[model samples]
Target: MLEFALLVTALMFGGTTLYSFGFAAFVFTALPAETAGPLIRRAFPYFYLFVLATSAVAAILLIARDPISSASMGVIAVTTVFARQVLMPAINAATDSGDKSRFKRLHTLSVVITLAHIGCAAFVIIRLAGQS
Candidate 1:
């Protein structure tokens, strides 16, 4: 279970890091802006869900072996919930309402939250590797 937890945590870390750093940029560069924007917006929910589920399970599995790591994962999971459920809809609403400033602000918030999640997942992975 510990090994599985570590694998999941590593996956979360790698997935987010890769997507944010490379894939998203490649996507926008390759696709038309109108198409890419909506496509990325559509993909965000699935990305958040992956973070939420993986982090939640990793936290549960880490609780006995490493309480602090577990708590960090929990924080990531909770933040993802907010990013997915609350912030996302608000962002979409701002876009629909043609409020460019509001959309940018909300989008920035979402990006920060995702980066924080990636950082937390990386911390957990480092801690786990140290234990190995």
Candidate 2:
């Protein structure tokens, strides 16, 4: 159980890091904003879903052995729901409506939330790892 939890938590960290730094960065650099923008918008949903599923699973797995890690994962899972369902649509609407300021603010919030999720996943991994 511990090993499986660690693996899932690592997947959470790696997925976020890769999507945020690797895929998102590469897409923007390799493609123009007009092209990259829509592509990233499409890709983000999957990213959020990944965060949600993995964190939820990890939370369930860690609940008995490590409440702290489980709680962190739970927070990540819950925040991801808001990010995916409410926040993402708002960002898209802001962009579609040409509300640049609103888009920027919302997009920044999304980025921060994702980064914090990454931190939480990392923390959980570190904490759980020390158990063995």
Candidate 3:
């Protein structure tokens, strides 16, 4: 029962991370610069605040629950790293674009971060599946 609960929690966290990433990517890539300009300008403050809130809450939950097993820890670690190191940077880069070179550099960094995030998620998911 406890294992099942832990698995469910892990899956939920993983899904949340994926969902957030998907939304950010879609907003960044699909929306045109002009179209996204106002939207991003208006939304960024709220979005960042929300991200911070979520991160704090998640950290509290993880610390409290303190996943005893290795697999659980892996899931938490991967998701947390991806959120902080990858997704946040990607979103920031996507929102702030001024110069061509700056945009190019940020875009490249975002891609790299995204790919790393996906790889980490895949690895964690596979590990979780193997445990089941």
The best candidate in terms of TM-score = 2
Better of 1 and 2 by lDDT: 2
Instruction: Give the Å shift of residue 110 in candidate 2.
Output: 0.6
Off by over 4 Å in 1: none
Candidate 3 residues 11-91, lDDT tens each?
544555654476665776889967765665565445434434443443344443443333343444455555556655665
Worst 10 residues of 3 by lDDT: 64-73
Query: Can you list the residue pairs that collide in candidate 1?
Result: none
Per-residue lDDT for 1-132 in model 2, tens only?
989999999999999999999999999999999999999999999999999999999999999999989999999999999999999999999999999999999999999998999888988988988997
lDDT tens digits, residue span 36-92, model 1: 889988898898888889899999999999999999999999988998899999999
Model 2, poorest ten-residue lDDT window?
A: 123-132
Ranking by TM-score: 2, 1, 3
In angstroms, give how far residue 78 of model 1 lies from its true place.
0.7
TM-score of each: 0.95, 0.98, 0.45
Off by over 4 Å in 2: none
Any runs in candidate 3 off by more than 4 Å, and if so which?
Answer: 1-32, 38-97
